[model samples]
Target: MRPARTTVATAVAAVAALTAVTGCADKTDAASGGKGGPAVHVTAKDDSCAVSTASFAAGHVQLAVENQGSRVTEVELLFPDGRIATERENLGPGTRATVTAEVKAGTYNIACIPGMKGQGIRKKVTVTGGTAERRDPAKDAAVDAYRAYAQAQADATLPKVKTFTDAVRAGDIPAARKAFAPSRVGWERTEPVAESFGDIDPKTDTRADGLEDGQKWTGWHALEKQLWQDKKLSADSKALADQLDKDLADWQQRVGRAEITPTSMANGAKELLDEVATNKITGEEDRYSHTDLSDFQANVDGAQKAYELLKPVARKNDPALSAELDKQFAAIDTLLAKYHDSHSSDGFVAYTKVAPAQRKQLSDGVNALAEPLSKLAAAVVK
Candidate 1:
């Protein structure tokens, strides 16, 4: 007979994996603020979970869990003494739930079901004394602003994606390229948020997949390579674009079904930022060699997922900020087009060979975008 899917043994092992990585910088710092606390925020994803800050004292605390993925999942906060302080069950995608628990300052484990077993994604938050800092009204406003922008950006890009995918399917390179520009813009406006994690060299990093080994056929590099390097269209490219379109549609549907709350969007953004940092800091390019690209793809995937969840709330909450985000998203599209047209395969080869010092400058430029983007996001929640 097949093994039981949710057996105690399986759950124990999964919980253990979460415990190992729980103390890593990702979730803990987010919840504890790297200090003692009362207000804690936790973000949950497919294979892992993260807290907004770290190190808290034992007391009454409000713990918020933001579900950024599509599927329903649970997040459980386990104490060192083998007690469950809090457990949130069946949290729908793009939604959030909160629990106020009396937690002692110590180590704790946070885990997701199925995928991240034995990976040690748990976090340790120390609770000491004093009430948690009151939420900043200004920062809260900024968060709301950026959330609006991000949602508008997503909405604007949908039509462009449809056109681009259709053009690719029709074997119209120029048209497809034109369509691709807008999608790239969506990414660019958000690039600052993407950059905060650090530098990512698509060429040298084996983790970048399709760009590194020449097998995978999706994402920015994949589409860019087809337009320039291969100079030939294939059925797979169209198929991949179609998949993206479907994903976007699903995201739209989910957004419509849920209520967009400030807590949910803020929690989602915090989680995405941590995921990006985790991928940039700890991901090994060579580990993904057998597959295609680095976990950078996963990193971006999470950001996109979080945006989808926050988009509706943003649009409903702040229309003007949403418009501004759309404009920036469009600007990003133009930049990618210029970069792709100039670089090609030959350009990528040469660009990748630049001195490390020069590369650092480029990396700095890319990563620096995160600050402004983060500011924008923070503006939304404010």
Candidate 2:
């Protein structure tokens, strides 16, 4: 089934912000690090994907991919030389596979397709010096920090999702619409990827009527039409609403009642990270109009709050994990600072500074962090 779009959107935005600060790094200077063999680890889910490093060395590369989403996911590895080193298809949820390929270094892209065209995750990795380094403590800490930030963010906003879903279930369209912005703020940073839906205008789309016109509706406009414009609602609309409520309820129950163990926190982090990564790579826009970078900034703020609440428990359970979590927070701070500087008050103002190709490069650069961040979350909980 299609997962909750609003939650995914908020998560994507938060992820993007986090990536902007902590995940985005230049790895062209390969000689600075110690000599090591080349290896890459990747994780894939219905909503996202992750990679081990943004840069790597050329040679024999081993890519480990894991699917964490509820639906089937696929991952493909591409080389700058225009070659597909490996393609893993139909990797069901909670399953993983490894692929070995001879990579010639330079740069590469990893694409994960969870749904629709352009509705997939893509990341760029650099292969420098012909070798890769094993996991470093600092790198590990950064990953943990990112995971902790994501988990905290999700925890804070999940209640808002429940509220929205409840209003929808009660047929309170106005309430549901009102609740949309607060809930969607969590994933607003990754608007570029979230807006890629062909049938929807991520800027002003919505999904008011469930399964109507067979048009694959999306965004706030679609939602507005469904709630205020559409004169018709299929029998499935009620059912969909019911399902939506149930999904939100389930999420609330799981998140609220579930023990705040490392595993659970890690799982939550994984989900958020996946959403973020997917949006970064896929550029699927949200269905809500207000779901923008500012909204995402709010989500990041919420995540910070959540992290504070869970900090003690996270540290008590794993000190190393806690330290890592701090790194992610720092990274996020850096990213937001940079993003704010680049965008000014408007969204993506830096877009005008770069060539079209460079803009694409920026997008690609953002995608590279998806898998690594997700894996870092997994490591914390695992």
Q: At residue 351, what lDDT does model 2 achieve?
A: 25
- Return the top candidate by lDDT: 2
Per model, how many backbone clashes are there?
Answer: 55, 39
RMSD for each model, in Å, please? 14.0, 13.6
Query: On residues 1-382, what C-alpha lDDT tens digit does candidate 2 reach at each position?
Result: 1222235554454334434433322111121221234446677766667887898666545566666777556566665543345454444456554444445557778888763224378888887666453444543554455445444544565577567656666777767666665655533421211222212222223333223334454333344345544534344555555454444333333332222323223323333334433332233333333233334344345444444455555565567766766766556555545445442433432323335464344344334433333333323321
Give the 10-residue window scoring lowest on summed lDDT in candidate 1. Answer: 284-293
lDDT score of residue 154 within candidate 2: 43
TM per prediction: 0.40, 0.38
Model 2 whole-model lDDT (C-alpha atoms): 0.45
Model 1: per-residue Cα lDDT over 91-184, one tens digit each: 4455454544444456766555323222235776665665554554544554566556555655765786688778878889877655554454
Q: List the global CA lDDT of all models.
A: 0.44, 0.45
lDDT of 1 at 56: 55
After TM-score superposition, the amount by which residue 194's alpha carbon in candidate 1 deviates from its true location, in angstroms, is 12
Best by TM-score: 1
